[model samples]
Target: MHLLRIALASLANRRFTALLTVFAIALSVCLLLAVERVRHEARASFASTISGTDLIVGARAGSLNLLLYSVFRIGNATNNIRWTSYEQLAAHRQVKWAIPISLGDSHRGYRVLGTSQGYFEHYRYARSQPLRLREGRPFAADPFEVVLGAEVAEALHYRLGDDLVLAHGVASISLLKHDDKPFRVVGVLARTGTPVDRTLHISLAGMQALHVDWQGGMPARGAARVSAEQARAMDLQPEQITAVLLGLHSKIATFSLQREINEYRGEPLLAILPGVALQELWSLMGTAEQALFVVSLFVVLTGLIGMLTAILTSLNERRREMAILRSVGARPWHIAGLLVLEALALALAGALLGLALLYLGIAAAQGPVQAHYGLYLALTVPTLYEWTLLGAILAAALLMGGVPAWRAYRQSLADGLSIRL
Candidate 1:
């Protein structure tokens, strides 16, 4: 107890240096916490996108490519599966449900997905979760009606019943337009923190109706356009679709179902286990994740080293003070305790301050992340991993400061009361 008091008193005498060390540690802690948050939330967002669905089927291609197009709206499919292929597998006895996704267009920057109401029923993201309607109901027999994801609605400032037209592929504007087609917002889905948040969902028939007059990729650039009424009557045959989401009747059938679809010679196609494909994607992405971790480690090390250097450099300036303390009853052990206590105190103060900074940063960026990044960073209670990270930081601080503490102990024992300052 006496040694603790001496340590506290010693730190109080050098309050400026102590505070500087604490703040430096605090800054590093903030960065470490931030990286962990981003990594955790990213994994959560990816896992949530196809929670209920067991498999994702698409034209034969890499599993990662299929996931990116079918679930993430990241890139277009290299080739679309035939409607016959999707229908054949969707009708399989082992299949519980199927949701077909037709992709080829966008509205402004938001990807457009042509699907059926079955999507609202079978498609799950995050953790086998159902779609939650933030406003309005799912499409009720309205052909040109569309539902906006939370991010889409917010970014585009769309409200219920707002009319919008498709932007050819991803182009915001083009020389030609589906002059005959437009859709109105019938519903708005709540945030899912997935690619769904960046998509505009409409019926498959709507996709067909929009391109009915255009025989190929585009209509004659300066040519005559058809009327919306006429498009409503035209045959909107969805000859092909980008991919189909699969739900198995039995969980055990996943492997057999995947095998069946892959071996089916009806047409070239692929079936991907959503979970396995997800793992593969993460593995491919593992390098980037590891790199981020390494950077965070360096950030922490730099801060700890800086604190150590500052205190050690200042230790030389305090030789006279140490000699005076030696003249008093303070022993070498007492001087060592004081240095160690100063380091611990700085670490504790920095940890608390860093937590505050983390909260403020998350709160400030939450809305923007939800809107632009299609990610919801709810300030849920901290995880055990985060506690572990903080513990490690404090451990590093102790080890770093121990070097200076040992040096001071040696000097105090040597100088005693008779030595020169």
Candidate 2:
């Protein structure tokens, strides 16, 4: 305990350099912990995006590609599934429910998803949490009515009864505007921290109405246009849809249904298990995660190296102090112990400060991150792996301190006596 006090007092005397060293390590530790936390939480958020769905059936393309466009809204679908196929599958005896998704439209960079009221009834996310409207009701009889996600409304500063125009493409600003077929915001959904939060929902009939004058992805020259009111009187059944989310009546039927869908004679379609696709996506991303982990580890190593440098450099200035201690009957091992304890102290302080920094960052950014990116960063206690990481950092610091400690220990009484300063 006396030696520990001596070590503390010595560090306190050089608080400036000690503080710098501690801060360096603390920042490194903070980055490492933050990366791990984000990686874990991101996977959890992605996996929970759409739950309780047995399959995501779409036009035959790469499974990852379909998952990306359908769930994450990262890319576009290669082709669309015919609406007839979606209807047939939805009416299947083994299928409990089906939610059709129509993409390829955008409102201020947010993807527009055209679906039925069954979306709110059957779609689930984050542990089977059902979608709920924060205000107003779902689209009713009006073909021009729209529902806004929490993020979309908040980002665009929209409210119930606000009129908005959707673009023909996914770009934030497009020349192909559907201004004539403006939609009134009827409902704003509660935030779910998923892709749903970044989406705008409208009835499937509403989607067909917007494109009544377009042919082959472009407005036909001199084509007679159907006004929003006239669109209601016309057939609005969609010829094609982007994808269909399926819920099975029985879990045992998943494989059989998947095979049946894959082998359908009418058109080529693919049925993917969300969980499997997610796992595969993560597996493909493992290399990038490893790269990030490696970079953070190097940052930590650099900080430890800085601490080692500071301690060793201070050794020259402390020679007289060491001589005085020797004259006062301090042994060589005592000097070594003091140096080792100082390194351990600095590392322990850094680890604690790093933890504090992490929580502070999370608290500061949690709201905005969820609001903008639809990522919910949970503020939970550190996992066992994190504790292990802290322990490893401390252990590495001790090993690094050995170099200065050995130099201090090897100083003989004669060497202390020879100190002229």
Candidate 3:
């Protein structure tokens, strides 16, 4: 306890340098923990993006590609499956429920998804949590009515009953607009921390009505144009769709059904187990995640090195102090132990300050991060892994402290009662 007091007093004497060192380490520690937290949350969010659905079926394409477009709303489909194909598969003996997905439309920057009411009844995420509306009910009966995702409504400041026009293509700044067939927002889905939060939902009939008058990728001019009322009066059943999500009556029949779908005589289709595809997708991204973690580790090492440099640089100025201790019958080991204590003090203080900073940052940025990125950064206690990382950091600091501790030990012994010039 006496040696600890002396070490702390010594640090207090050089409080400015000590504080700077502590702050540097704190920033590095905060960065490392922040990166780790985001990586963890993102992985959880990615895995929970879609659940309850057993298989994702799309026109024959790479499994990763199909998963990306179908579930993630990323990338365009290579080919669309015939509506008849979706109906046939949806009616299979083992199939419990199916949700057909129709893509290729957008409102502002958000992608528009045309799906059936079964989507609301059957789709789930984050441990089988059902989709709940924040304000109104899901679109029913009227084909021109739409449902907005939480992020879409919040970012665009849209409210229930607001009319919005969807663009003809998926581009953020699409030139072709479906202005003649404007849709009213009937509902806003609660945030799911998934890609669903960034999408706009509409009925398949609404999607077909938007492009009904278009011929050869161009909207009909003058005499051939179909008005919104005309579209409502005509048949609007979708001819083709982008993909389908299926739930099975029994998990045992999944493989058999997948094989059957892949070898269908009508069209080339690819059916992938959602869990398997998600794992495969994550494997492709693991390299980048590891690289990011390594970069943060190097940053932490740099901070520790700075602490060592500060302490070693101060050792020269404190040589007289060490000599005085030696003259007062202090052992060389005592001097070494004091230096180690100081290093440990700096590291512990930095780690605590970094933890406080991490929580503060999460509290402040939680809303914006969720709204913009659809990533919910829960402000929770650090996990065992995080504690382990901190323990490793402190251990590394103790090892680094040994270098200066040994140097001080040798100097104290050699200098004895004489002050070095």
RMSD of each: 3.1, 2.5, 2.5
TM-score of each: 0.88, 0.90, 0.90
**Each model's number of backbone clashes?**
6, 0, 0
lDDT of 1 by residue, 1-421 (tens): 7767776777778888878877888888999888889888787776666788888989898889998888888888888888988888878899889999999888877889999889998777665668889999887655688999998898889999888888777766655555457788999998877788888998998887777657668764434555567666767669999999988889999998888889889877888988777777878888999899899889888888888887798787877778888777778877777777777777878988988889999999999786555567778767899999899888988887788889988884465444345
**How much lDDT does candidate 3 score?**
0.91
lDDT to native, each model: 0.82, 0.91, 0.91
Mark the 10 consecutive residues where model 2 has the least summed lDDT. Answer: 412-421
Off by over 4 Å in 1: 220-226, 234-237, 356-384, 412-421
Candidate 3: clashing residue pairs, number: 0
* Candidate 1 accuracy as TM-score: 0.88
Candidate 2 lands at a TM-score of 0.90
Cα lDDT of model 1 overall? 0.82
Clashing pairs in 2: none
